[model samples]
Target: MLEMLDNPQLVKIHFETHDDLVLVWANGAPPLVAEFVQVKGAEADKLWSVADLCLRKKQAVGSSIFEKSLDRDQHEETACFRIVTLRPVVSALTPLTYKRGNEARAIDCDEMVALKADLDGRMPNVVSKRGNGTGYWLDNCQWDARHDEVAVKTHNRMRLFEIMQAAGSLLLLEHIDILLDELRKLVKTAGDAKWKPDKAKKILTRKAFLTMWDACLAKLKDDAAQPSGGKLIEKMSNASLTGTVVAMAVDMRLDYARSVRTSRYMQPDEASQLQGRVKSEVQNLSAKRAAGTLDLDGPAFHALCVDRMDAINASLPADQGDRSAFLKGCMYDIADRCLLRFDRTGL
Candidate 1:
């Protein structure tokens, strides 16, 4: 399952648990913790319906901003958060007549902040809870005080992994686009197409991408190092590195298009479409691998991309959008083809 996550744009993994997980938005932002209504046994179903209705109402009524604090930046910050409680369906032993109040409870915004602080202190190396723990697996945490030798070194390695994960999330596409702009200007002013290829090739090399990925990967790896990051880092290898590089290049193109001055100048839908297609195909490949179809980059992949491109071109409307979008299409084709070939042929 871990190996399957080759490239993720936005992924939310659901876990079965009663422990509340806090979501802290961009920095200095008040956290939001989803509150579940307690529903015992069969009453859970009724509460789930009620909670759904409440969420719909909240959406309809709209939210009003509430000022939380004015920080040292002189920015008058306002935070508007709503607490939602849902009684989700569990196992047969945890039946449907379950009332939300009996089965589950949600922590408020304040409680979430306190929890974050507590978790940060107690599980200094741990990031967030991925899932539940059981008997022999009770000490399932990534960071353990018990294992002396493996604990310390592996913990640091986990930190690096978290750094990479965080780096991936940081949305450095904007910076890449900015740099691309400078590169374009330099090329245009020089009036030398010959020079441009050499310059661009230098920018888009494995070494360059690796350097940047290392920096971001380090940051992400650190943030979730101890338990979560350790698990993730253990999954990384040459194939993972290649996927990361491909994803970064695609990300650069997407970011560039999003920053175009006019909406027509860059169409995000194109990139989004391509992203969706690639993600689906990758997932399918992962499924095939699981089913004993170990040849990931076989003929199946080429057919997938060919079908994908046909769909993309079919959906295109007559408009000259950003070059990056077109470039991305080609990049996706080449990257996926190469990835599959590499997967099949090996390094």
Candidate 2:
């Protein structure tokens, strides 16, 4: 599928007996020595193995050469050849021949621009670093191949992670509403005259809540920046990336809620009620997951949480009283935590 074309731009190649050479040809065309040359005679087959070893070892140290001198006299070319190890071949004219042949015709700005555009379309960004050396060959033939594979795997993992984060976020928001409802009832039953139901919405929109959400979002953004993998095994392991993202979201929510309560809004009794319910939920979910009784997928976890919320609501007092605002805050905390964990971990 690959082809080479010649243009007015001159390219000269010099042969070096000290180093290995590969004769590249078009798919249907005969092997023609333009600038590069094939092995003198019997060394042709060894070219492939040498290329492979060069790429693998990342060194130019030569091993034994494959030669046909055993059966053939110094003059004749023989088909049969064998590999042998020795020091690298060196010749007096190798350097001079290469230096002279590297010179090419000067190009005007227009031609240079066009040529650069052509190359940009064909090669990856990394390939532009090499002009016309062995480094270019290594970049295009070896490193680029590996990089492409890693890029694909990384993208897949990030895609799955995003899905999990989104689902978890939705679940947490719903749970937030349930927690608020429960909190209102608890406040009312307490007969705490100081509690203000009217201020609940204001509290929900407080700077503290916004700050916590911002922190959680920042963490998610950082996760999104994780690099991709190159190996097949790594790509396949991305199956669990989504779950891991979800778990992290849950952890962020829990930590934020705790920070809010402990730092600026200390309400031990109210916070304790919310925390207790969440602790119980986690324990129950953990047991269920361990026993293979609950599925961690979106539908299953959401349904179970909804049922639990209904039960929690029914158990609360009829009137939320003056503590309605406090209850709503607690609910918000619990819901976010539950949603995050259930969404990702499937528990």
Candidate 3:
């Protein structure tokens, strides 16, 4: 749940059990969000229903808020609440029924509507025997904590893309959109169902989108490093580095990234995950160039790659690990991967 809220825009955040989670609006602009919220399961089963549990808590909290309001000296802050459940509310045709005190009634209408009514005090207060206060309720809500990790992650991935866009990383956002659009189409096409919302989430969630963005930033740092900041670095244009140089630079980096990914230290599954992360950058690089956004000339590209290498070399000790030095060596090797070195004679 917190992971979903780890957005750049969220100015304040907190978490708790029973309370579950708490968030306050930041900048008062973004309309909050649908945080994915993975639900856990058990043979013993869940402790509460979306409507029942929250309906009760809302009354209790509302009563408290009401009591506090009477004091006038005390102030109460409004909070939103959400209840996520593994099971979907069955259809009214199924005649879902529940006990409200000694009476049981058919859930003859939309369950959520019924729930909202209970929460808002529009219906008979079934929260507790006390039924005091106007009844507590949320400003907004959802029942997202689901058993499906893919669905959960997929929901979060889209939110993460929103975060990226808000952060002004347009190139990364467009790339993720392209990939997700294709993946969603492929999933629905393969399922052969008319179309369900859940199918799309699974296919796109498995790949780490943020990790792809991190790789892009690393390349940007590489781009910024071009000419190693000798005044040239301050104004180096990606246009300074041509397309051919970038393709070659990506090739060398991928090989290094792959070797690290598949190293014996990594478990088979872990290695695959690492490879997946690097490969995403390769794809994004291709997309960006195809879009004509990045096309630095030879000198600029060389400087970018070299600066990234220099940063690594400066940070670590010269002999910390043979493996570390070797990685740095790979960076240097690509310093001229696409450019031919010529003597002053110009041969």
Candidate 4:
């Protein structure tokens, strides 16, 4: 799944298909290419052998591991097959262990000949189709083995962290836990049986995944950008504010943070200008209080808040002139950060 996320060419991912997972990629054209993967959680002591992969359930045809993987093969779209397991394969299958290079894996001529003979003996008709079925399978199939679940998870987290860093994420190390959890939930939801017959729900497109990823990053940024309410509540309490008013103020501060973070209903430049204007107003208000012209009373604080809201609203264009609540929220957010004060004492 992490690999799919890292791949730029990947367009869609399908879970719990004929294969364990399927990855689709496109190159600005008609037919789409796909890679079908079969995941095996084998015991540590087990080793995959040619005979084991060819073994059929109750002697039934097309029930073997190799046959099942080949069943997903379609001539309509160019596709490759893969078997990923936690156990190693026999020495005869060493060619499958080779890493992906120009192709999925490098197949030795002698090894392919012997494997083809073995598969041909087991399923002559199936192995002889499309000129040479075993040859095609040998060319496209990859065997990725000895993957420890815990190690893969750790690597996935590291990979995700690297991706976030490359994308200039401001999220901290602790936030990776949240992001990973969300990704896990997304995969689980995509694989849910209830969504069967609706491929849209079962498959995630790259565009949709990117949008979701951006939302997750934005939420982390918003959470980090917002000031904690504890100090704000204490300062408001010192100002003799009612509990209800203090709670409302804290909520407004959160609203302001989200609006600024998302640039909600505003262009990026407009949002920045509004924030700069609010900060300038805050500094001016602080200066007035320091000059002893502004009284250190709850009524005075309320009046100043309303006055600033009105002033900011008047400055905005006609379309945005009704954002009094948003302007007040911006002031409350400044107060939350100790940049604005309502009382004489700097509590």
Between candidates 1 and 2, which one is better according to lDDT?
2
Per-residue lDDT tens digits for candidate 4, residues 91-150, read 877677775443424455676678777877876767523344876787778898846878
Ranking by lDDT, best first? 4, 3, 2, 1
- The positional error of residue 315 in candidate 1, measured at the CA in angstroms, is 6.4
Q: Summarize candidate 3's per-residue lDDT along 1-347 as a digit string, tens digits.
A: 22323444443323221122334344355554322122334413533443433343456644442232222211133333344455554332111223222122322345534654654453344242223222232212233445565786567566655454455433232234444554446444434432254433332221243454466556644543343332222122233543655455545444454343223332323333333433343345334544658564447444544554445445545543333333433443322342222111111
Instruction: Find the candidate with the highest TM-score and give its number.
Output: 4
What C-alpha lDDT, on a 0 to 100 scale, does residue 229 get in candidate 1?
26
Write down the TM-score of every candidate: 0.23, 0.22, 0.33, 0.62
Highest-lDDT candidate: 4
Please provide, for model 1 over 1-347, each residue's C-alpha lDDT reduced to its tens digit, 9 standing for 90 to 100. 11112223112211112211111122233432222112122323342321232232244331211010001112122211222233332221121232323322222334333433443343234212322211111111111012243554444334433342444432222323333344345324433333345534222323443454456445433432222222222222223433554445445434433333123333334444645555565556556765666554434554454455555555656574324354344434334334333234332
What local lDDT does model 3 show for residue 324? Answer: 34
Where does candidate 2 stray beyond 4 Å?
1-267, 320-340, 343-347
**lDDT, model 4:** 0.72
lDDT string, candidate 2, 1-347, tens digits = 00111221212122122122222222233432222222333233222333232232233222212111111112221111112222222221112122222322112234333433443343324221112322222212211011243554444334433333443432122223333344345334332322255333222212333354446555544432232121212321332334554444344444544343233333333445655665576567657765778756644654465466456555666663233333333333344433233344433
> What's the lDDT of the predicted structure labeled candidate 3?
0.38
Superposing all C-alpha atoms, what RMSD in Å does each candidate have to the true structure? 22.6, 27.0, 18.9, 12.6
Q: What is the descending TM-score order?
A: 4, 3, 1, 2
